[model samples]
Target: MLIKKIKRRIYNLFHPIQGELWCLHRVLNEKSVFDENKDLEISPDYLETKIKHYKANNFDFISIDDVYSKRLSEFRYCWQKKFINITFDDGFEDIYNNAYPILKKYNIPFTIYLSTDFVDRKPLIWWLVLERIVLTKENVVLSSGVIYTCPDIISKRSVFKQLCDLIYNEPDNPADTFRRLFSNYVSYFEEKTANTLTWEQILEMCDSGFCTIGSHTVTHPVLTRQQENEVRREIEESKRIIEKKLQQEVLHFSYPYSFWNEQVQDIVLESGYKTAAMGYGGSCRYNKDNVYKLPRVYLVEEST
Candidate 1:
């Protein structure tokens, strides 16, 4: 642990940034057997520890709005106080059930990027579907007519990644495409989406005043994989739906699956978002970073 801390400090010394936008998905009481889902879930206890550690280190917990406002101000590259903005993607119910109380206790301001369709009862959450498939069966047949065996953890992990890539590149509706492909093994996809938040719950979070809701595309498709028109519709429609429902303008966005390109960024900006966040990157350097394609640190249990 000491060495890890030292190594982080050395890395930061060379790669300095103004602040970190911490990206997370669900805050669960316990992790699941789905290995991919484990990367997306962190315990409530772990969330609290992270909050405490950042506070102890004197990091300011700011909102997504604040992150945007900083861009307009005079940004000094040297001797700056570090800030942290916590963000949750996909609007999971566990965030309300497990994470909100802890965040409220610390009085931390956070953002939630909603896919909108999650609440509207659309989207298969393909990775979880893949997890269910691999864990349930000893051997699986791929779309390529290739038979993959995963009787053990090692093979399961490998096959999971392989399937995930295939789904990620699915140009058409990924949920529909994959659901049709794995129909026999994935009847529980609809039931599994119960884990996501409802519209009322989302509004309740907004009522807390600490939560800033952002658009994460309507169906949460990988924008880069879709046609330009489809990408535009996804970006614009989600923001439109969110703003209409919340009676407040949505100012930020998070790319679904962290997959985006220059064209997608243009659509996000034209759709009226002040900033757009990507899933993986170290931190934000105020002066140098592009607001449209801002990078974020994906925080899991083992993340520092």
Candidate 2:
């Protein structure tokens, strides 16, 4: 392990990454061990540790706009100055409650990609509902007559992953499919508590000057599976809604679930977004051609 670590350090020293755009989902205190989306979250302590580590390592913390400008600049004077930008997807209220304070402490500039419908209290956040059902009920019987029995944390996690795969890969509308599957158990739409960031919270973040708003589509649909018009509407209308709500031109976007094709890419370009982030791919290299498809590393607890 020591040898491998030394080798990696040497390799990285010679071939440093241009920038790292971290894609984070939620920053909150952990809940149940059986939480299916546990991987999507990291504790506030972990987030602070990451920020401190990067700062100690000489990584220049910057915004997505800085990323765009640096990548576009033809002159290369400071190749050794590595940069990292942080961004959150889905506009979760946990960010405002948990991550915001830590980020503010460090004076970090981050971006939040908002799905308008989520903020609008729409039933699009089906995954959280699905988790609640699995945890509360020992046996869940889908409307399709398929039954999942999650008697323990291990089984609960298994069931959640299985159902989540089905939801994401569902040929029909995934959100609608979630409702149809759980129609008998509970109504997916009416959450008594707000889970997403409100426009008020968003406005406050905007005022902070440390937060940048980006579009994550109106309903956070898998664009590749959607109809051409639906895809266009999801990409274009989301930009419009966010721009109007924030009263600022939304220049950046992120694919819902990182599911996109060339057609989806074209729509983002046509929609006038300067850049779009995706779920996977490691540190971003300065590439002018990949402006629309800027890759990001998901900053889970395991991320370095």
Candidate 3:
């Protein structure tokens, strides 16, 4: 791991990534490698390390809107320096708490794609509930009639992963099964108190000029699993809500769970988002080439 970090630093210095859109999930002060969704998180200090690294390498911290407006050649004028667009997914409160300060300190521009319901006092993220369910319960009897006995944290992690994959791959509405699991283990009142970023915090960020807010859909559903009308409503309503609250044009959209199809792309475009971000790993060569489905490399503590 140390060697990989060294190599990456070397590459950042020697072989700078040009026009990279880096996607991050949550940033907290915790350094433990084992935690709920550890792979999706980085310590606040580690986030600063990355920010400093990019700064030292002369990377321009660009926003999603900037990418949409500028041509690749016209924008990336620096022959040696690279340009990066930093984005955070899911709108975790930690992003407002831990990350916003680090980013504010560096004066780096960034965007957050919000799962509106996650923030808007509605249903909380089911996956987090799933994680809690697996960790706390010694044994689980799933609706499928399979019994999982997680005797330790290791076993819990393994079982949690299997169940998560199973939920995602199932042919039915995964939300229904996830709710069933949540109720079986976690309290419905917990759903009411899933305090994500509040409207005031989001407004402050938008007013800061360093942050741009984008839509991450209403309920953060896997769009492919829903019907066309449902998907359209998900894409449209989220953007509408942000625009209404912020009183500014919300111009970017991101796929919830990095799940996007042709239908999803068409809806995002039709809904007036100028550019949208998607997951998995790669750099965008040109903005116009992938305005709707921009590729991003997810930043994690351990390099692969």
C-alpha TM-score for every candidate: 0.87, 0.89, 0.87
**Candidate 2 Cα deviation (angstroms), residue 42:** 0.9
Tens digit of lDDT per residue, candidate 1, span 1-304? 9999999887666556788899999998667565567889899999899999989987889888987896324464446677889999998888899998998899999999999988847557777777877877798876556788999988888888887767656676667678766766656666564478888888898898889999898888778888899998999998889999999999999998888789888888888889999888878874667888788998867644
* Root mean square deviation (Cα) for candidate 1: 4.5
Clashes of each: 0, 0, 0
Which segments of model 1 are wrong by more than 4 Å?
1-16, 120-122, 143-145, 169-173
Give each prediction's root-mean-square deviation over alpha carbons: 4.5, 3.8, 5.5
Segments in model 3 whose C-alpha atoms lie over 4 Å from true places: 1-17, 31-36, 71-78, 120-122, 181-183, 186-194
- Mark the 10 consecutive residues where model 3 has the least summed lDDT: 71-80
**Global lDDT of each candidate:** 0.82, 0.83, 0.77
Query: Residue by residue across 182-255, what tens digits does model 2's lDDT show?
Result: 88766545754237888999999889989999999988887888889999999889888888888899999999
Q: After TM-score superposition, what is the CA distance of residue 147 in candidate 3 from its true location, in Å?
A: 1.0
Candidate 1 lDDT: 0.82
Better of 1 and 2 by TM-score: 2
